[model samples]
Target: MSLLFAPFKLREVTFRNRIVVSPMCQYSSVEGMATDWHLVHLGSRAVGGAGLVITEAAAVSPEGRISAADLGIWNEAQAERLRPITDFIKAQGAVAGIQLAHAGRKAATEAPWRGGQPLGPERGWLTLAPSAIAFAPGYECPREMTEADLDQVSVQFAEAAARACRAGFEVVEIHMAHGYLLHQFLSPLANHRRDGWGGDLEHRLRFPLRVARAVRAAFPSHLPVFVRISATDWVEGGWDLPQSIRLARALEAEGCDLIVASSGGAVPDARIPAGPGFQTPFASAMRQEAGIKTGALGLITDPAQAEQILATGLADMVVMARELLRDPYWPLRAARALGADVQWPVQYQRAKLG
Candidate 1:
């Protein structure tokens, strides 16, 4: 039997295969609401045979959005819009997951196609961070967060997870990676605060851990909560694999079911050895060192490559983003390539060659 095609059970949810459609932001929302575009974009992956279809970083608050067009679930109205999409994914035998996120100092930027440049107050609201630091040139210097701000944002994540449950999502992945809110706190390069929320690794982990705990508490008890974290800053004196392992262990104690191991995005200057499965070692290390199940992402493209990652125990699940976008049916192709007998949608069964 192919391990890649074997069912993966976490809590009460069981995935049909190890192929997960990692969150890829569409940047097509209006007032933080997911539209028909999101439904079609996400639903197709489920139809294409991904076992777990994770939605993009759905901001926990308006200010948490990476851009004005990013998805949001801060309100019930926005949460309700996701029900149909989740229902469709469940109908297709895939688990529907949502990643609750806060972009922190990285917020209020234009979408990638729009140059991703920082916007002024006229176009975007003020951003917040652990310290008064700017992400890079042209980015606004974010206001240093107060103690009250931390409590409020933590509650926002919890509330967002609760709303996601109402939206019919089975899993909630905390977006603590990609130089976003929580990750900035994790990395010393972005977070230079001298207070309880920074100055040391434990301090830096405070808020992210609180948010993860709160989210886990708010979501359904039987459902699993995953956290996507940058395993390394890839820059010296920044967050590294060892720190990630510590964070993962603490998170598991707080009920995090899996850690999605990814790297970089703490700074633009850091050198990353980018290649096929370049970051798989981080996932491997995180799982081995932290004693947690991990999802390996970054440059995981080909079908056989994904299978190999799973079969070799490099990671528990293989997350594919750009590759899945290029071929929504990559999982189906992978299943056949691995010689795993997987069921195709009735409409597409005629196209099956395996």
Candidate 2:
């Protein structure tokens, strides 16, 4: 039996296979509302046969968006807008999920295709972070989060999780990675506060852990909650694999079901060796050391490579981003490539490969 095609269970949700569509920001929303673009983009992936399809980072607050067009789940209307998308995804035999995020210092920017620079006062809003630090040279200097801000952020995440459930998402993944709000707290390079929310690793983990606890409590008890973390900063004295393992352990205790291990984005200049499976090692370490389920991300494109990662006990799932964007039916293709018997959508069964 192909491990990549095997059913995987967490909490009460059972994926039909190990293939997951990693959340990818589309930069295609209007006032943080899901548009038809989201429906077609996410629904096609479900029809393409992914076991689970996680939506792009859905900002928890208006000012938490990475770009003007990033999706948001801060309001009931936005959550209601997503219900149809989730309904369609589930109809195609896939578990629907959403990644709740706060961009922190990285908020208020233009979309990548539109130059992706930090927006000025003409369009930008004040950003918040663990410190009054700018992400880069031309980036906005975020205001240091106060104690009240910390409590509010935690509450926002919990509210977002609850909204995700009402929107029909079966899973809610907290966006702790990619140098966003939670990651800024985790990485020393970004967070420079001397309060209980920063300083050492323990203090840095406090806010995120509290947020995790709140989100877990807000989400359904039976459904699974996942966390995506930047496993390393790739910069010395920044967040690294060892720190990630500790965080994973704490998250697991807080009822998080999986660690989607990705790396870097803490700083703009850290060198990352971008090659296939560069991040699987971090997933392996988290699973083995932290004793938690992990998903291997980053350049996981090939069927054989993905299968090897699971067969060799590296990670429980393979999270695909670019590959899935290139071919939404990648899981179906991967199933055929691995000689795993999986049902194709009846509408297209006539085109099934041998």
Task: Give the C-alpha lDDT of model 2.
Answer: 0.94
| Ten-residue region with minimum lDDT total, candidate 1 | 345-354
202-253 per-residue lDDT for model 2 (tens digits): 9999999999999999999999999999999999889998999999999999
Q: What RMSD does each model have against the real structure?
A: 1.0, 0.8
Query: What would the per-residue lDDT of candidate 1 be over residues 78-189, giving only the tens digit for each residue?
Result: 9999999999999999999998999999999999999988876689888999999989987888999999999999999999999999999999999999999999999999
Assess each prediction's global lDDT (C-alpha) against the native: 0.92, 0.94
In terms of lDDT, model 1 sits at 0.92
Estimate the TM-score for candidate 2. Answer: 0.99
Taking all chains together, each candidate's TM-score versus the true structure is 0.98, 0.99
